[model samples]
Target: MDITEFEDLIDRLGEDLSLWPEDRRSSAEELLGHSADARALLESAHALRNALATPPVRAPAGLADRIVAAAKRRADPAEPHAEGETAGN
Candidate 1:
């Protein structure tokens, strides 16, 4: 397997090379053994996999209300004044 073939495998199977089809796995591993570029590709895939594996951060408390308030202010600037309050304050 060459760099292009290795990249195609990564794109198809993602960071987990074990998930690659059996026929392609050995050649992909061989490419990884012989090429620095292939190793870099694998490292990048690992980083991306790690990032995606992480849980999503929670929004700060009351953030949804704040966003809705902001959207409402944009949608109808006069509405807040009609209620004698600033939209986001």
Candidate 2:
């Protein structure tokens, strides 16, 4: 498979080559053997998978509440603003 096809397969099938169909896995392995770019793309896909699997960092307490309050203030046209600010300013 070409590099473009390889990339599309990575997006569709994820970073795990073992889970790919036998035909596709063989073709992808062939491409990876000869193309440094393909190897690099596979490495990047693995890194992205590993990163996504990591536990997300916790947000600081009250951050979500502050965001919701800010959004509500912006959405409510009747809501009053501070002395120097307008609705969107």
Candidate 3:
């Protein structure tokens, strides 16, 4: 399949593999040609997928408070911006 076709279902790949139901997987195996190049690509994608499943990097000290303070600063500039203000109104 082309990159565009694969992109549509790419994110669901790992989840779908768990529920492949055997028949669909068998068909995929056959269609993929089971060639060396395809096998290599599969291995690379598997490793990349595993890496993506890892937890996000932890923030450094005081980062959370800094973010909250920054958000407040942004909101402060919009003072008196009440519900009825209606933005452009």
Candidate 4:
């Protein structure tokens, strides 16, 4: 199979060659044996699949509360300043 066909198969069947239909999997393997570009494409597809499968990183605990508190302090005109400080000081 050609590179375009191989790419289309990757898109449809994902990076797992074992999950592909028999004929397509054989064709993809044949192409991979002879073509560096096809191997690279398959590797890249695997990397992308792995990246997508990874769980997202979460914010630290109390981060939302800290952000909200900062916003409220900025928004409230009457919020207390440090001791001995005046407005616009």
Candidate 5:
């Protein structure tokens, strides 16, 4: 698989296992026949996908900080801040 395949799989990730076809699974199994690392990576991705569907017991508080940072970067600085005229204007 290439970047497009990975990107597509990521897009339809939630409950869309069809991205990984059964035939391809057999191929993967064959490819990883003796490679533990490959098998572990595949298992890890599967577990992560499964875990994504579960609701968090506690909401992440850092989201507000992240949103603020994103907004600051995206926000126009209140009419470009006139020279010597404070934002209070």
Candidate 6:
């Protein structure tokens, strides 16, 4: 497989070479062995996978509501400015 296809396969199937299809595994291994760039790509993919698998940090309870309110204010062009703010000021 070309580098783009190889990268896409790892991204779709994840970081485990063993989980790659039987026919593709040998060629992928050879590429990994010979190409520094391919090896780096595999390592980067594994790092991303590990990062995603980490437990998420919890946000403060009201954070979601605050975020939604801010988004709504931004989305609504007619939303009123807070006190003391002028149209062009």
Per-model TM values vs. the true structure? 0.70, 0.67, 0.42, 0.84, 0.37, 0.63
Worst 10 residues of 6 by lDDT: 80-89
Clashes of 5: 0
Off by over 4 Å in 6: 60-89
Pick by TM-score: which candidate is best? 4
Q: In model 2, what are the clashing residue pairs, if there are any?
A: none
lDDT scores for all predictions?
A: 0.84, 0.92, 0.57, 0.89, 0.57, 0.83
RMSD (CA, Å), each prediction: 4.1, 5.2, 10.1, 3.3, 10.1, 5.7
**Candidate 3 TM-score, true structure as reference:** 0.42
- Per-residue alpha-carbon lDDT of candidate 5 for residues 2-74, written as tens digits (9 for 90 to 100): 3334444444553234556787545554655766765555566778878986987885889888677556644
Best by lDDT: 2
- Candidate 3 residue spans exceeding 4 A from truth: 1-12, 15-18, 31-33, 64-89
lDDT, model 6: 0.83
Task: At residue 38, give the lDDT of candidate 3.
Answer: 45
lDDT string for model 1 (1-89, tens) is 78998898788888787887888988888888889999999999999989988999999999999788777786886765535556565
> In candidate 6, what are the lDDT values of residues 1-89, reduced to their tens digit?
66887898897887799998987888889888788889999999989989999999999999999788767766775888656754553
Q: Give the lowest summed-lDDT range of ten residues in model 5.
A: 1-10
TM-score for predicted model 6 compared with the true structure: 0.63
Evaluate model 2: give its lDDT. 0.92
